[model samples]
Target: MSSVRSFVNLIRPSIFVHCEPIEDPCGPSATMADLN
Candidate 1:
């Protein structure tokens, strides 16, 4: 979702440097926590 993308974008320049570009591919519960 766009909301998830926005969250990832917010962190992309910092802690997310080594993260994948999967876009919440891991599902809602975990992704939601990570997004927050």
Candidate 2:
């Protein structure tokens, strides 16, 4: 499960970049907080 999470984390940055124009709470920063 951790490996999957890590894999998702790797790809999330690109998605985050594309989604950055929106004021969404599911950004990388929020994800990191959730991960911790």
Candidate 3:
């Protein structure tokens, strides 16, 4: 169960980024390019 949850957690970020990439954090410095 724990492993399944971890796997879901791993895939979740990618799914979220695909859903809303602009809202996802890129790095230490946020870029306006993402907004554009």
* Candidate with best lDDT: 1
Model 3 TM: 0.33
Worst 10 residues of 1 by lDDT: 13-22
Model 1: per-residue Cα lDDT over 1-36, one tens digit each: 556667877977454433445556665566566665
* Residues 1-36 of candidate 2: C-alpha lDDT, one tens digit per residue: 555556767988454222224365675666456655
Deviation of model 3 at 20, angstroms? 29
Better of 1 and 2 by lDDT: 1
| TM-score for each of the candidates | 0.33, 0.33, 0.33
Once fitted onto the true fold, the runs of candidate 3 whose alpha carbons sit more than 4 angstroms away are 13-36
> Per-residue lDDT for 1-36 in model 3, tens only?
555556767988454221223454674246655554
Give me candidate 1's TM-score against the actual structure: 0.33
Error of 2 at 16 (Å): 11
Model 3: which ten-residue window has the lowest total lDDT?
A: 15-24
Candidate 2's C-alpha lDDT? 0.54
Provide the clashing-pair count of each candidate structure: 0, 0, 0
